[model samples]
Target: MNLALFFDPLADEAPAWGSTTLGAHAARFVDTFPDWRSADLALIGLNEWRGSAAGQPAASAPDAVRQRFYQLQRGTGPCRLVDLGNLRNGLTLEDTYLRLREIVAALLEHNTVPVLLGGSHDLDIGQFLAYETLDRPVSLSCVDARVDMAEEAGAHAEDTHLRRLLMHEPNFLFNFGQLGHQQYLVPTSVLAALEKLHFETLRLGEIRADVRQAEPLLRQADLVSFDLTALRWPEFPGYLPASPFGLTAEEAAQLCWYAGHNDQLTSIGLYGYRPDHDLLGLGAATAATMLWYFVEGYYHRRNETDFTSRRFIRYAVGLPGNPAKLVFYKAKRTEKWWMEVESLADSSVRRIVPCSYQDYLRAAQGDLPNRWILTQALLG
Candidate 1:
C-alpha cells in the first residue's frame, strides 16, 4: 500500500528552535515521503471530525497539536521516528474509516508503532479494526469521561463508536477497559452491559486517588484510545463535552507514560482534540507534554518480558483451603510484578499477567485476588 496516496505533507511552519527542538532532531516523512521500513515509531495525523457527536467543534487538531509538539526538546534516547504527515479524509465517514484501518494495519505489519493524532474519539473504531484484520486478540484500554455505548443517538458518532467496535463481526477483542469514566456521565445500563462481558472500568475518583493502580490495566492493553475530553476544562479546554471534573493535566500525562511503558501496547490514538476551543493554545501544550512523556517512557522500556531472566525473583505462596499455589515474579530491574495463572485445561500453558504489590499481599493473606479469578474465568 502506497501510504503517500492518503497523506499530505506537514503545512505547519518551521518551529523556532533553541538548541534542540524535537522537529530538528527527528526525521519526518513529509513533502517527499520516505520509506518507513526502518522506523521504530511512525506518527500519523487525522484532521477530520465528521463523525464527532452533535455540535461538533471545528477542529484542525493535527496541526494545532503539531505546532506545540514540534517545539519540545527531544528527551528520549536515539529513536527512529517519522511523521507521516496528515491523513486525507474520504468523501464519507465510512470511507475515511477504511482508509485509516488499512494504514494502521500496514504500519503494524512492519512492526512500527503507530501514534495517531486523531480527529474524533470515534476514529478509534478504525484503529481497533486494524487489530481485527491482523488476526490478533487485543485488550483495548480507553481513557474517556463517558462510556460511549449509547444506541446511535445524535450527530456525534463518538456516542455509538464503542458499540460499533464491540458489535463488529469476527470480534477479536479479548478484553476491554474504560479508565477515567465519570459516574454521572455514564448510564446504569451501560455499566451493566460491560459487567455482563466481564469488562473492567475505573471511575475518575478511583484513578485520582492513586493513578498507579491503573498501571496493571493499562499494561494489559495492546492498544489505547485516549479522549482529550477526559481532561478537566481548566487544564485542557480543547473540545466539546469539556467537564469541570475530569483528570487533571498531570494525571493525564502520567497515564500516557503508563501507556508508553506497556510492552504489549502497540498502537495509540490521542483523540477528541478541538483546536477551536483551546484557550491560548494551553490544551495543545498539555497534549504535547503528554506525548513527550509517552516518548520518554518508551525509551526507558526495560525489556523485562522474560520471567526466567536472572533479574526476576520467584515467590511461591500457599493459599488456605485452595489446593493450587499462587506464583509471582518480581522484576528486580524494573520493580514490576507478574502473577502466573496456569491454564486449567492445559497445564503446560501458563499465563503471566501484570499484577501489583497489593495483589501479592492479598495472596500472602490467603485471599484469592479478584484479578486472578477474572483471568481464570476468561481462560476457561
Candidate 2:
C-alpha cells in the first residue's frame, strides 16, 4: 500500500545543531515516505478530533505532539523508527476510522509496531478495529480518568466508542482492562457492567499506591489506548474537564514502559491531547516524554516467551485439596513470572500468563490466587 497517499509528509524543519536530538537519529518519511514494512517502529499521527466534545479542530494534533517528540534525545540502542507523518481526515468520521483501521492492520501484518499520536480518546475505536481486521484475539487496556462507555444522546464518539467496541460483531476481544480510572468520575452502572464481563478495572488510588502493580495488567494487553486526561491537571493541563487528581507524570511514563516491554502488545494510542488548551506546551512535552520511554523500553525488550527454554526456572506447589499442582515459571534473564493454565477440555493445551511473585506466595499457602482464577474464568 502507498501510505503516502493517506498521510502528509512531516514538513517541520530540523532545529539547529544538536548531538542528541531525536531528529538526528530517528528515520523520517519526510521529503518522500518510504516503504516501511521492514521498520521496527512506525509512528502515524491522527489529526482527527471530531470525536472530542471540546469541539477541537480535526487533524491538528499529530504535528503539535511531534514538535516536542522530535526534539528529545535519542536512545543509544539501534532504533529502526519511521515517522509516517499525519493522516488526512476523511469526509466523514466513519471514513477516517476505516482509513486508520486499514493502516494499523497493514503495520501489524508486517510485524511492525504502530505508535499513534491521537486527537481524542474516541480514535481508539479505530485502533481496536485494526486487531479485528487481523482476526487476532486480543486483550485491550485503557488508561483514562473516566470510563468512556457513557451512551447519551448527541454525545461525541469518545463518550460512546467503548460501547460500540464492546458490542461490535464477530467479537475477538479476549480480555479488557482499564487503569487509572477515577471512581467518582465514572458511573456506578458502567463499573457494574465491566464487572459482569470479568474485566479488570484499576482505580487511580490503586495505581498510585504502587505503580509496579500495573505491570502484569498492562502485559496482558495486545493494544493500549491511553487517555491523556488520566494525568492530573498540574502535569497535563491540555486535557479537557481537567481534574485536580490523576496519575503522576512519572507513573504515566512507567505504564508506557510496561506496555513497550510486553511482547504481545502491537499498538499504542496516546489520545486526549489538545495543544490549544495546553499551558505553554507542558502537555505536549509530557506526552513526548512518555513516548520516549516507551520506545526506550521497546528497544530493551527480551522477547523471551518459551517456558520450555532452559533459561527458565519452573516451580510447582501442591495445594491442600487440589489434585493438580500449581505451576509457575520465572525467567532467569528478566526475572519475570508466568503461571500456567491448563485447558480443561485438553490438558495438553496450556497457556502461560504474566503473574507476580505475590501470586506464587499465595499459591504456596494453599490459597487460589485471583490472577489464576481470573485467567481460568476468561479461558472458560
C-alpha RMSD values across all candidates: 1.7, 1.6
Error of 1 at 364 (Å): 0.9
TM-score of 1: 0.95
> Which structure among the candidates has the greatest TM-score?
2
Per-residue error (Å), model 1, residue 325: 1.1
> Which parts of model 1 are misplaced by more than 4 Å?
54-59, 152-155, 345-349
Model 2 lDDT tens row, 49-114: 778777765336667787888888888568788888888988988999999999999999999999
TM-score of 2: 0.96
Total colliding residue pairs, candidate 1: 3
Candidate 2 overall lDDT versus native: 0.86
Q: Alpha carbon lDDT of residue 55, candidate 2? A: 73
Q: Name the 10 consecutive residues with the lowest summed lDDT in model 1.
A: 51-60
Candidate 2 global Cα RMSD:
1.6
Q: After superposition, how far is residue 123 of candidate 2 from its true place, in Å?
A: 0.9
